[model samples]
Target: MMRTIMAIVAAGLAAVAVQAAGPGFDPRALKAVAGPPNEVMVLGTPHLSGWPKDFDAKALGPLIDRLAAWKPQSIAVESLSGLQCDALRRAPFRYAETVETYCWDATPARQATGLDVPAATAEVERRLAAWPERPTASDRRHMAALFLAAEDQGSALVQWLRLDGADRHAGDGLDTVLVARLETLRQRRNEEFLIAAPLAARLGLERLEPMDDHSADRPYRNAEEEKAAGAAIMKAWDNAATARRKAADAALQSGIKTGAGVLALYRAYNAPEQAQTIYDSDFGAALKEPSPERFGRGYAGYWEVRNLRMAANIRDVFAAAPGQRMLVIVGASHKFYLQAYLDMMHDVRLVDTDAVLR
Candidate 1:
């Protein structure tokens, strides 16, 4: 009986070994050569204030320099792709608005590529349809240029990547094309001008990836309840943290000309205390929306939907290749949730912003 038991155990071990070696797999060899695990650092940031705040784009230079020093392979931002030209062709009405939005301010692309929105849209569709297995740098340049004309920076971004890694250079027409669109781009209301896009340019990255999801906007079931709940929440925010938060933001914006000032704000913004206090005070506090119970829960649910979607998008960046460093620059309110969901991922290792700030 003992001999039979030993035999069965040995057989099980052999089966396991065989499974591990299936189809040219080499467990030890693969492990030895595998690159480092993917690392992500989510930088919690205040969205640049518009209007009377006098958000000087040049003030963010120090902050941009620090991020460029981090040397990430790809940078993902909170934006979306442009040309779903393929999908739009199949269902024009469904995507008519998208084309219109991209086309509305696509003057820079028209000036550069001489293609209007409809013309640029057709070119994107045509190019993508006949995309080659290996696109030449010239081929990529034209496609990237065309996507820019269509105002699909996200789609234009992918075309930019099609070039050889070393061939991605600034003022190559595609990279520099958006430079001319800077003033016009600011009206779009994003932090891209302040940090993300400029940092990408400095780092010689092909394009920025937008990972924000808005598919599940406002999940609250009761409108009357939601309105009341929103009011209560706003009152709490205004009553408690409004003055202090605004002061800090003002100071940071004013002093960002220096690296020391930027680093101080960076460290403070990413502090655990700040995250905990905000979560406990704002998102955690419950009040009457429709019913006291339902409103808070609904708000939390919507927050979860947004963060989970954002987290999934970040994860997708590392799906094809691990060991890539990604930095997610999002609203400070989103930092804790993004970190929480991303931490749960098996292959994801969250880099300590505290260390980087130091």
Candidate 2:
């Protein structure tokens, strides 16, 4: 009886997946409307400056021009509210401070810091250099995860790697070795969790904006409550890690070969909406920051619930103000999942991020 119930549940999930991704995806639906449709343009944009030889700015100029020609009412960016507190007309930049360096290589940051402009470039170069020629798909996948982790965790990537027991190479060019070690650590620690947010930013039609505040703790008024909250959060993370491991194992067993397949497995089994809530979760003075509730639940509650709220808010906001061309800039990882949510709603037209980005 248990097996039968499990089989039926699995069958239902498979049906949902097919309905979400397969068929009914009309290419014509991607075209620009007489005006912006009820839906916002979700563009998957790349924050990195350099693309492999085939993906240079010269290659992207035409695409940028096309988007500009489309003339969005406003190009919503991924900036923190505080950073963009200035009046909209007075706002100097459209892109968030986090993504400000997209067009050119490290410009003002490098120059102001007096660091070699190229030297300050992300060690992706070093990683690319250290890699074996003609890296396998797994190697590329691992590297991608590492690079992304380094970006997400910032300096924590290196520190956490050492904790993970990956040997720190201490030979010549220690910086490169350290970077590699950190990347390896990120790889081990599960960096895909970090990529979804950036991925969403890239796909959103307009510039990105910081939708959440991710500040760390300062002197707390209530230390006891803080400690208790911290403990609770840690416990939640432990649970999430367990679930994530089970999900990974299931994916491997299921022969989920491609990235999309893995993501689908992640969504179907782990529930991305919940995962995103973990990302956006906030703790009060006692808790501090977003915590993966399953593992630690510090301040960030269940992501599934938060994602649902965000989607509903987005949907309602659109519905509340009808006939307006709205562009919602969210993380790329949320792209597919949000589309699934949007699809379930009525009087809405979903625009493909691919059409806008390409």
Q: Write candidate 2's Cα lDDT for 122-160 as tens digits.
A: 444476557564544344333333332333222223223
lDDT of each residue in 250-341, candidate 1, tens digit only? 87666655566666777788987787666655676543334545656666777789789889989998896677999888888899889888
TM-score of each: 0.65, 0.31
Residue 107 of model 1: what lDDT?
69
**Model 1 worst lDDT window (10 residues):** 25-34
lDDT of each: 0.67, 0.40
Q: Which stretches of model 1 miss by more than 4 angstroms? A: 1-34, 51-54, 83-144, 149-151, 154-183, 186-189, 218-226, 236-254, 257-259, 286-293
Candidate 2: 10-residue stretch with minimal lDDT: 189-198
Query: Highest lDDT, which number?
Result: 1
Error of 2 at 129 (Å): 54
